[model samples]
Target chain A: TQLLEQSPQFLSIQEGENLTVYCNSSSVFSSLQWYRQEPGEGPVLLVTVVTGGEVKKLKRLTFQFGDARKDSSLHITAAQPGDTGLYLCAGVKNSGGSNYKLTFGKGTLLTVNP
Target chain B: DAGITQSPRHKVTETGTPVTLRCHQTENHRYMYWYRQDPGHGLRLIHYSYGVKDTDKGEVSDGYSVSRSKTEDFLLTLESATSSQTSVYFCAIGNTGSPDTQYFGPGTRLTVL
Candidate 1:
């Protein structure tokens, strides 16, 4: 089984503080995705990185894929209270014959205090 | 938001009872997946369907079963509910062209006591 290890299971910081979350795995993945889930709701996709050493930015969030495709990072700049939620990283492996499955990390819960 | 909906957004039942969760989608996507989220376990896939009447087990499919009789509807059944099965269930639809990107439903919260 492929497992994703996420660092800093819990984080709490002031509104203007910047933070970063990391996800690492020993197995290589075809693609990696990041999601943010709020209380009482399903997770929403934040970004998908498919290439090695790739970086994508979404407003205040920046996502990067490792050079080996086995790790990813999410960095938030000047976070706000609205950015508080659970962040999840998912890795997809090609199962061949139109079958691809995703393995998710335990997730990092962030609390941005006002 | 995606055109996905889940019935019985919240449910409470006792152990040894049978429970079924429904997922309906209007996107007409070819792939659908069922996952359960628990504390410290993240979201684990229970089952997935590739097409009508075609389904496959996922990593945590031991105590769960799924049926996809039609393209728009997928059902997950717990033959005998247990306390361990109490978790938030999420249904997701995958794009045909991009299998990695999935749009999830609102989710169903099931509690078994």
Candidate 2:
């Protein structure tokens, strides 16, 4: 089973619409990160949240971390076509022995029509 | 980015063949990782390195091995490739600051027939 779960698996909306992507987990994590990936490129870090109940904003996108550090959400305001990509959320968890591993969600594939 | 590069972005091999993929980073980050991305599975880590000659297995390490002979290069090898081993491979480097952020190289697509 995946440590992180994201929904909905696929979303398509028109430009100027608003949407939210969620990542939930039963296990608590040290940090949560959001990444966006285009068709032919690797995923790029969009934002990282550490503190519980922390919130971050990058332009039209807003990211919120749950108070328990077990969940996170990404909200896009007035989504654009350029935002069409795969949105992934990962949680950082200690694997013991001075090592940390990232557990990633399956990702939400979003498409915005212009 | 972060000066990370993967060689032979695409490869096709037959079952039972041995294959090696290379990842080189110019940023001199202390940690390097290898992950395989597949549909519905997201990215599953195969192996990682903490420093020169210091490597460890990750969640899905079967049929795979890694070597870090130097600070700049980390290599992932398939001892005997199988059809199930075909997937997109990504290399990442990080752990530079608080919370540990990673930067990935363009992925390599591998196909085993």
Candidate 3:
């Protein structure tokens, strides 16, 4: 089974601070996706990176896929209280016959205080 | 947002009792998935359905069963509840063309005491 390891399980910062969360794995992935979930709600997809060294930006959030496709990262610029939530990284293994199944990381819980 | 709804948004049951959670979707997606979220464990897939009357077990299928009788409805059942099974359950719908992106329902919080 493939595993994605996320770093800094818990993070707390004042509003306007910049933060980056990393997800690493030994196995290469065909695709990687980022999701943010608020309390009492299911996860919502933030972005998806399919190519190595790919980067995508959504408003104040930026996501990058590693050159080796074995890791990914999410960077938040000027974090706000509204951005506080659980961030999750999920990946589809390169060798998996099916693309529907995904391996997920534990997640990073971010709290931005105003 | 996806047109997905889960019934019994919250449920509390005793050990050995049976419990069932219903998922309804209006998107008419071809794929539906069931997942359980636990602290520090992330989200684990319990089961999924490819089409009506067609389902498959996921990584954590033990003690859980799923049935899909219609395109818009999927059901998950627990034969005998256990404290270990207590967790937040989420239902997701996926399009046949784009399986990677799935839309999730609000979720159901189940507590087995």
Query: Comparing chain B with the reference, what is the TM-score for each candidate?
Result: 0.98, 0.96, 0.98
lDDT of 2 by residue, A53-86 (tens): 9999999999999999999999999999999999
Expressed as tens digits, the lDDT of each residue in A49-114 for candidate 3 is 999999999999999999999999999999999999999999965323233877889999999999
lDDT by residue for model 1 over A16-47, one digit each (tens)?
A: 99999999999999999999999988899999
* Chain B TM, cand. 3: 0.98
- Best TM-score among the predictions, by candidate number: 1
Q: Pick the lDDT winner.
A: 1
Stretch of 10 with least lDDT, candidate 2 chain A = A93-102
Q: Residues B24-78, candidate 1, lDDT per residue (tens digit)?
A: 9999999999999999999999999999999999989988999999999999999
Model 2 lDDT at residue A65: 98
Better of 1 and 2 by TM-score: 1
DockQ by candidate, in order: 0.77, 0.59, 0.64
> What is candidate 3's lDDT per residue for B12-92, written digit by digit as tens?
999999999999999999889999999989998999888899899888999999999999999999999999999999999
RMSD of each: 0.7, 1.3, 1.4
| Clash number for candidate 3 | 0
Q: Which order, best to worst by lDDT?
A: 1, 3, 2
